[model samples]
Target: MPDRVNDTAAAYCRIWAERGVRAWEEEWWLLARDIGDRIGRLINAAPDTVTMQPNVTSAQAVILSCFDFTPPRDKVVMVDMEFPSMLYLYRRWLEGRGRVEVVTSDDGITVPLDKLLSAIDETTLLVPVSHVFFRSATILDAKAVIERAHEVGAMVVLDIFQSIGTVPVDVAALETDFAVGGCLKWLCGGPGACFMYVRPDLNRQLQPRLTGWLAHENPFAFERETLRFTTGAYRFLNGTPVIPAYYTCQPGLEIISEIGVPAIRERSVTMTSYLIAEAQKRGWSVFTPTDPAQRGGTVSLQLPEAATVCERLLAQDFLVDYRPEAGVRVSPHFYNTDNELSDLIAAIDDILADMN
Candidate 1:
């Protein structure tokens, strides 16, 4: 977590301890909507159409629960390059509900666009895919996927977990039916703060079985005769809001909102391009897309003994992560400088040299 975010978290911890029961009605209940509105601008969606969730997987669960998974539309199409968590959730949820058809990636980096489109047939009920691939940071063709899914009467659910804060996204332009993302990555909102976007029209239509009292039209009324869901994105939410997480998320969201994603994206593209160029110059394989248009904020360097190198980098207080096939991932955000990236590459070289 960023220091500013941590500071906000600490402030909230004090508020929770100091205010106690008085805070809930006064301000705690409003954080979800406040955060949702802030998140809406990031993705180019209306504020009311977005809702706060515990995580992306929870949001996915709510969307999945909305459908009956009946015949003629019992198929869910997705890409192999999507985050494993989404796949895991869908596979387990659909085991008894429906079936999942994953479009395989030819090189374990980018998804085959043609194959992905072909797999979304008339029988397909949902097409869930990542806006930017988790491992390689490859930006998917969201508009094309949405178009194909619509042609077959299938709804497209985009997981923008990797792209929302760093890459430019217009959910309205893409005509995506649904979108889910978290503040954990580029948003810098830290863990436990995630959001889901439902189209205004779709918001009125979905009745999520994975829901709780908070989603009720009159939650405090405690009426159990007939469950009346609240209109708008609130219907997607389940259980009490994670207040502390919401509090911590504000600093990051405020920072990103002020700088604007377009500016951040430009910085990200430049820095990641530099990272890719530097890695490639050393005869290392770059797993992320070479084209800035096809990439997000991250550049994955396919290094020899990458796992060991990543361990050493962490030991040196260099924060980077390693994935099995993607190797060492270096994500440079708007706050990062070109010199830091260069120094990081140098550090990698030093680590590799020591190993040899």
Candidate 2:
């Protein structure tokens, strides 16, 4: 762990000490609101356009369930490479009513944006895509896809879990109708905290079907007859929030904001580039894009014995993850340095040579 990482964690500890558990009070929905606002600011979106959620899955469900889709126009488009959560949610939506048409990518690992655009007709109500392919770390042209979807009067929902803190995103500039991401992984926010972005103009248009007392305009009034939804993106929040998790996450978010997204993105790209170069040098097949512009923090390498390799790497104290389709996935955060990546590559080389 670097001094900077420790310092940032310490700062959060100080915040927790000063504010105590009372930091996340019912009256202080402003704390949640401020976090969302900061996220929007970091992503170059309007404060009113952002909302806090329990997780990305909850946010996606809220966005999907709210849309009024009729036959033919009831279709939602997604690529085969999407995370299982998104696919499962869309499948559940299709079970009784609407249809989910999955567009197959040329390579099963990457979604072809053109194919996705071609699949969207007027019948398409929403075009949902993962900003970065979880398994392969393949980056999507979210801005272009959003712009194209709007041309056909379709709403674009982006699952930005893999790219949220790893890559620089401008929700407003991208013109996406809805975007969902969590604090875990790159955000380094402990678990269970997520954020959603809903375009301000589209807030009223998209109603919340999974509403709870918290989302009600006047929860304390206890007016059952009159269920008034919130005026902004906050309406997406379904129930009481996890105070501890939110508090734990605040520090990580603050760290990213202060360090700056552009710098973080640059470091992520550089680290991944170095790892990819080293893997290629070792004659390993790389799954992630060679171009930094088309990649995120994760870099995948092809190895025949992925499970065995992953287990060995873990035993060796090198942190990495495994993806079924792409073999080993190495996701290095900005706090991680080139030396750490070099050490990981060296370990991989030794492991492979020993296997030979």
TM-scores vs. true structure, each candidate: 0.97, 0.92
Write down the TM-score for model 1: 0.97
The list of candidate 1 runs beyond 4 A from truth reads none
Candidate 2 lands at a TM-score of 0.92
Segments of candidate 2 deviating more than 4 angstroms: 1-28
Worst 10 residues of 1 by lDDT: 1-10
Tens-place lDDT digits, model 2, residues 12-97: 57766887756546334665677788778877888767788888888888887786687758888889888888899888877877
Evaluate residue 333 in candidate 2 and report its C-alpha lDDT on the 0 to 100 scale. 88
lDDT for model 1 = 0.90
Model 1 lDDT per residue over 76-152, tens place = 99888888888999899989778999889999989888989999999999999999998999999999999999999
Clashes of 2: 0
